[model samples]
Target chain A: MDVGPERNSLLAYARNWLVGLRSGELGVLPIIGGLLLTAVVFQSLNDNYLTPGNLVNLVSQGAAISTIAMGLVLVLLIGEIDLSVGYVSGVAAVILAQMLLPDGSDLPTGFALLAAVAAGMSIGALHGLLITKLKMPSFVVTLAGLLAWNGVVLMIIGSQGSIIIQDRAVVSLSGSYLTPDVAWAFFGILMVAYSISLVLARRNRMSRNLAVEPAALLLLRIVGLALVAGTVVSVANLSRGIPFVVVLITVLYVVLNYVLTNTRFGVWVYSIGGSIEAARRAGINTDRVRIYVFMIASSMAAIGGIILASRLRSVDSNVGGGSLLLYSIAAAVIGGTSLFGGRGSARSAILGALVIASIDNGLGLLGLGSGQKFTITGLVLLAAVAVDSLSRYGRIQAGRS
Target chain B: MTDAPLLELRGVSKNFGAVQALKDVDMTINPGEIVALVGDNGSGKSTLVKSVAGIHQVSSGAILLNGEPFAIRSPRDSADLGIQVVYQDLALADNLDVVENMFLGREQTNKLGKLDHNGMECRALEVLDQLAVTTIRSVRQPVASLSGGQRQSVAVSKAVMWSAKIVLLDEPTAALGVEQTRHVLDLVLRLGQQGLGVVLISHNLHDVFEVADRIVALRLGQKVAELDRRTATQTEVVEAITFGRVSSVPGQSGATTS
Candidate 1:
């Protein structure tokens, strides 16, 4: 064996691994491995668990929670919390349902959706303004919003208990699916476009003499993405089709994910979340960004409400309350985002939501009670937080050296 | 010489409710000079600097900037007039990279209106290079990952890059080690050499002797001495500043240079 070069490379790799471990980047491996192992175990427990139909159902159900979780992720990164998302969503649903009541309604379907989104955004902006301009803590402002918005929801619902959305167009939004052929075609187009963009971006960085990954690393990332895309498409082809919810989730993920990751707005979001004083000194209009962040959170929640109403065909006073809020926060946190702030991604919300949904799906199939599921979810959340805290401490200690 | 100073303060005082932090202080920094301001704790050195930085409003003062009558009501107002203050705390975000921290509030945008990171990184690298700062590794590295001296370097570069005609540094080398202190002192001299007025607040006489062209001493919010480097020795400057006179007479410290 060639001892010199091989031993040197091994030492280098070891050093890299140690650095990664300290930085929390290596933390993802164990989580991914655990998820894969869990999936295999569940699939063996019941063959149906791995079937295409159930998987599609699993992903579809995660879309709404994932969207709201994305917003919560932004808020949390800024070292703040919004406790009113559930009620804000419920109020938005109630308002939308009222607008959708057929006879000579003052607003059309598209206009009604826009109005509902605006109203949700306005409520969020109001909270942000009260906190930033009036110098109130966001926690208190959002808590007050929690009670106030729920009251508005109850008033909107009246004594009717439930308001059914008979609008066919709205129902079709989250319930229908594209044909199998169309789904495959669309998936093909997406894969090609994604690959091209990745390649072009790498090339641009290389030409500019900016630091980028080596060619081998870039190839590995592209190949990995290809495999994931191919697997998803194959599984979708085996099922009936791509559900409308999946398409909706994809659209939201792509748009918001890009805005959060690759743009100035994304940088501002992280900066504000990291340190308000630092961000302000950097010349960011912190006040404006704060108002906009809250607005986005409430608006996305409104969209989540629309999806909920579309799927359930009704809106009620108790639509979004305790459990939904808990699930949304859990989804963002369990996806590996930091609760202490300045670290997280929009993609983590989807992952966390999937994890939550998977547990719910698995436990329900095993005939477990709601209490059992709740206990299990709580345990998972605790474990995730523990991992995060431990790794952060490790990073700090390493940094001190 | 023109009758106008680069920055002038008259009767600048600040009160925190019942506590009198600063009382009727007067000072001046001329163009193309290094002025070292020194005092003991609670001796109103910080209050005077804060007033100049616009972090605190003076209860009473007539301040002038570049011979213009100016009232700095906020940090933004001070920044607009090219007044950069580097506090001992450094005011840097640890999680952000060097370039990000340097251009935190004043980032360059591209035609697409995105943060033109390429240009900013290039500019940040150039600025550091011009200052002959070779201690830092990568400009992309977060400030948290840097050494104490490196962070101070970046903070100084930020103040310098902002075109600050008058840079006020508060205990810039207090938290620094020996090597780091030397590096900062060298940077201060370079700033003065570039014809930028510098107001350095320090307790270290060695550092003051190494960089400052003149020393202005404050004792309890009152100007006690102004010693040019060529005209006075360290002992004489210290005696004049500390006791507010050169000799201790029977009744009072005699007002004469020993």
Candidate 2:
């Protein structure tokens, strides 16, 4: 009943959101709500849970899994799952460790990193080819990849126990932090970039006579982003500043979000995810898109593995084994990336990773065992999936009516 | 009718190992004309449409565009020649918004390789407006939220974009309700009036008679009759489909109504 002038107000925004809720368009609200609720509960259980130092540590701990989760979002978008991401990361970590071995080839750290990433990408491409060309399901192919890549890691390590990373740059990836000054400067740059993008997008929309968001709403969003960035930078700077791995993860998130939201390739990816037949009919190269997404997923997983290795200062047979794969997938799904695909974002990885990390951090502070952690995480994963399915069902019912 | 046909299929035949799906089919689609392709079950009407749309390579015969013979080896090739097909399923990504779906594969990008969202939205609006589609509330709304008729309109508009000169719609109104079917039939007529060669493949004689300028009937993998709407009767077209141009009662050609 209330339309027109009130449309530009925050009340209108809330009203629209309510309307969206009724229509079953539950965007990121659940994840954000879960995140806030978890943070409160954890902080209450452990007085140090929300401390700046612990929060910073939680971010660094989450970086590796979050990076892999971002990649998982891509694969999941196409209604496919990559089961071998853990082992793929393991293969890269092994390669990195071998390259930096004391009496070994002594390759440059940069080249070694590239080589590790390349290996991960190559494996991804192989998986993609098998899935697309041979018409095999991604689940089976990646499952086989999981086992095979694990074997490759074992073959490379060869009972050497664990290789300590002596390379300074490699060790610094997760172990070191940015200085306060550098962190502040980075935040400044981020704000400027965000502002410029917003302005440009508005201008572009206006020029083409496409509907632009109300200027007030636009400003509100920009200011909101700035505030969040400022708070994060300030909080991290309170201690040793943001860790390099945290920065790395943030950069990955930004770049990936840009690619997914701003590019033609991104459109094609979502289209294929939404309906492969529709994408094909629209003349998209679905095969190429699938192959490329797999490559990206594996490469990011490898990068995550590298970060994990850096955090531990070593690469061992157990580097990517255990519940790492499950955690990464849970992060993506819990962050709101739909298992049915075509409905997620790169930011989902970050939010989901933070949630998982909070649980781990809280449990660790409480002296809980790995069994408890797994159980709680598995429960959380199930709840997230249930929410996803319920929302989808609601959407379908609403559409039909 | 005076200009060269936009698309022409000559002696087209397609076989599936032991089964011949299409046999020596000849058809022409001219600009500014709506040709209704009427067929019964297993009538090879789909095969004929697919052959022209390059979904199936004809086992024999040639396809011409603007009176020039061209090889249509794949769907891409057909699309490249400005021939677009709106399949029975509609082939629309239900999750994507109207503009996104409209520009899915052929998305425009800026210099930085970012999707030109504004440009795409503008173009999509233009296309929809040209087709006089006003039922859709927002271009940003996902296709899943659309009514059946609205979805059909979006599919038609998408095909008409990218400078498409010919559009093949396979059973566009098959899944629609009465009102929705009427809306789709109106859209089909508008498409023909816009000077694009329109092919309406349908089972409903009412729809076929309403919008089609000419009627093409297929029966048992062959074109049984091609009749001009101005001169042909529905009974004649029905008879052609059921009996395949051969009157069982030899002397009752003009008088057989039952």
Candidate 3:
């Protein structure tokens, strides 16, 4: 297919996106807009908000919630919520801490972490079975799970104020940073891989007689992505370089995004979310998909718990308590994943996490209390939901006529 | 039309506890033929179609595909047997685009198990083009963005894409406007022309007259009359639906004929 001169321009692409937005296909526009606005406001209030060191800290601190939110995205895509995720993460952390205690079990750090993740996954599967096979509502099942898992955490942490992690490797999972050279190499590899994939996708489209994006536009996107990667790497290197947790989150984001966008399972998730009866009529194994999604959600929560423990160098009764679940859910929704399901990506979790972390960090810089931070976060989440509902309404109106 | 029937239902009966939705009903659909099942609101049209589509199991019946007994216990079983149902709702996911909805359950994947988006898009375009569906602006557009006729076209194309030999359409044009209804009726005729046996359950006698080669009328959970469209008049089909039998008097109203 010949690309017309007018259509080949970046301006044309932008206009197309605008047209889609006007028709109520909101995509990632709201999140991007919110992120930019927040950055401007926060940077104006506190110059430290935009500093390389502070930005690096924001990325590291956002890693746990961001990781957990990715799992929530999957669950949300299936039109389900895992209310127990917060407590599930707590249970995992408690187990990890107990296993790592100097006077406790002598399991290796890797084995202990694996055991914690496994426990979380098992709990998730149990929830899935109950919801799918027993025909129980996910909300009720997970709500019960929330209370039961919290009780287990209390039982495990009885009489102990906190368990300090002594394993050096476990501590480094979140506390360590990559060298500047390694960070630069990572950025270079990402750029190369991204470019190659773009070219290959274009080729595939051409071979299939499908319309391919103009070469100029494709190049423009590649360059744009590279610029973003370069800026992030440069900013991190200006400090102590990228934190290991940030790298971990980035890898998780990439993998989850690929799975959600490019795989058959991902399609099933969206289909089931869109309409369960439709999915069943299409001959999809809805029960299996729901089960796997719950498992993924809880396993991700377990990963978040491990990161939290590593960051604090200790696990306590409050490891995964105190609004962690709310924050993670808010991040997913605020990043653009529809709470109603079938309309989100792993990128939403990352973007939303960044927004939430920025708010918390900026408020901390201003010496504001947690109360103010909670109020602002709640407002932002409400605003995001409002946007989602309005856009959905608009789309429905458009479809009807 | 082929001599051998593609699908046959004998003594199909379904009971929802105290209510008998279908009782001792029989139907035979042939290849390259369009059979219209006309009925009133409570005449078991939906129940019969659902039974054939495996959404509901018949309490007692023998379903034959190619002269052999077939058991449809699930939608998957029906799909595997080349039976597809384009329900009134169309069953298209509003969030997914045309290609995604077309291949929802049976997605094509590459060697690495990733969805082969390019391949699916190519096949989707081919199928849509074959059906001459041009109203869709872009194959990537979500179903929610399409008109009623376009959504129906996608759903039908999805059924065709699965190589279905028998297609059951329940009120394919019920909620459609005049133009869209015409489009769907044309597609239904084309499906018949392509040698797929089509069972279209509709209330519109005009649509049934336009596409159906044979008309099956049902009333009170029983198949009342089977008329060849080439020989039977609209009045006769209506009589069968209302009174479960056609009046013998020519050019006489049912009241006078009785």
Candidate 4:
């Protein structure tokens, strides 16, 4: 339908779908297009919307929610949902805040962070136990988790309505920025790593007599990645350099992406999501895998919570409240991660979160109220899920999924 | 190859609360032999196979593997005992490729603990090619794209790839076409000829007669008869399955509980 010129051809693009849309392939283009559309609309309306300072702020704000959504991708992949992640993060923040209360017995930043993460893992393990061992529906268990964890947050944050984080190490995590030279060097290294990994993977497949992409295609891939990375770094260096939160999110994105795609545990997660009975028949420890997934989700929530507190320089009742949960979920869906599971990757979280943050940042620049932002964001989330369902149905109808 | 049976079930009985799903079912599967398990719907054929695959724990049974009693409390235990199963619905994840499905639980990893994708891809190709399952377009393509028979082949190939001592196929040809069924039957024969024990569970009498060396019939949670294919007729096997009438076949086990 998008028949254009050869140089900018949609027909060429459709033909080049290594995995086609009909097969329910989650292409990055659609989400990127949405982002571009938002940028154009917002920049035209407001002068400051697309400025470097604003863009850096947008990344920092979205980093926390994006990390949680990254974990949600795994949960969703295995056909489970964790409604408690937002509150789980809130609980994580409060724990860290209390541990660093400066009451003479206040622990150092490193130990406090570790303690918070452990708590997150334990909470996830508990949720997994309820779901797997008791044979309870994940929806019910996680719904209950949402309520109970929120109660935990409320109780923990009692008396004092908010706790200001005074530890320099804690506050500076999301507040700091990479120097301009470091940002450029970091981008260079990232591009090089990307290129090398692609080459190595292609070589690996080829050595096994499996099909490999052409050399030209591989080169083009590197070029594309370099272009994107270079543009972001250049723009970021124009402001107070790249935010530390951006670096943290990017590193995790790569690491988690690899974990989801290239490990035995990762394959098991996908299999369990695809078909639990089948995974069991295949002799996979489905319960163990489920448990691990929950733990990972909670740990990610803890990280997100810590990042948010660092960015704000304080922990409050709204650490994971308001649109945090909604944004985390919407980010995943908006980035083309299937709610039904067995699809999507870590990139979905990063891109989806960015898209969401961009919209929020753009609307705020136009003096939009929280009411309008919530409504628009909700509609966007709905649209994403609807699109996911339609594509899934198409794949099913085509007998390819 | 040897005198002793590779797998033997003695006085096996399984109960699901008030209902008895398998009652004192005794069976032997020797290497290089095809044992076709036959029964009408709800006749404990599935239950017996599932129990062997450790999907359900038997209430009372002595399952002997190479003359040693083994406990199969879970599918993992069954797998560790060199038992592989191609379930009735072909428990292959549609989202995964043939290589991935074949090595789902028992994935090969490199020294660094990352997946050895290259090694796995090679091995999957070797097994599929060894089975002569040439209908698949590509092993890299997800099983979802494969036809019913192709998916079935991948499932069967998965069982064989692991060098399983005994392969249990539950209704392998149920959803297949005529040609596909023949292909599966041929593969079953090949597996047995390759010195592996094959238990083919199906209700199709014709399919049973094609490649099975021995036919074991179940009716209402009990073994009605075990017949040698050389000596038993289709009518006799069907009668045993539908009505629990043990035939006067020469190699009949005479375990008629009814």
True contacts kept of each: 0.34, 0.82, 0.79, 0.77
Q: Tell me the spans in candidate 1 whose CA falls farther than 4 Å from its real position.
A: A1-18, A103-107, A262-264, B1-5, B10-26, B30-32, B57-62, B230-241, B245-258
lDDT string for model 2 (A1-401, tens) is 34465465656777878887977778788888887988898888889888899989999889989999999999999999999999999999999999988886767899999999999999999999999999999999999999999999999999898899999999988889989998888888888888899998898788877876767677788899889888988998897789988778878989999999989888888888889999988778899999999999999999998998999999998878888899999999999899998989999999999889988888898789999999998999999999889888888888921
Could you estimate the TM-score for every candidate? 0.89, 0.94, 0.94, 0.90
The complex in candidate 1 yields a DockQ of 0.39
* Cα lDDT for residue A308, candidate 1: 77
TM-score of chain A of each: 0.91, 0.96, 0.96, 0.95
Question: What is the C-alpha lDDT profile of model 2 across B1-258, one tens digit per residue?
Answer: 436688888988898886777777889988889999998898889998888888889999899988999989899899889988888898999889999998888889878787888888888999999999888989998898899999999999998887789999999999999999988999998999999999999999989999999998887677889999988999998898888852222233573432
Give the runs in model 4 whose Cα sits over 4 Å from its true position.
A1-19, A101-106, B5-30, B54-77, B220-233, B243-258
lDDT of 3 by residue, B181-233 (tens): 99999999999989999999999999999999999998878888999999999
* Sliding window of 10 residues with minimal summed lDDT for model 2 chain B: B246-255
Could you give the candidate ranking by lDDT, starting with the highest? 3, 2, 4, 1
Clashing pairs in 3: none
For candidate 2, give the DockQ: 0.62
lDDT of candidate 3 over A71-133, digit per residue (tens):
999999999998998999999999998998898557888899999999999999999999999
**Interface RMSD of every candidate?**
2.8, 2.1, 2.0, 1.3
Candidate 4: tens digits of C-alpha lDDT, residues A156-268:
99989999999899888988999989998899889888888998899888777787666656667889888988888889899988998888888898889889888999999
- Indicate whether candidate 1 or candidate 2 has the larger lDDT: 2
Q: Is the docking of candidate 4 incorrect, acceptable, medium or high quality?
A: medium
Compared to the true structure, candidate 3 yields what TM-score? 0.94
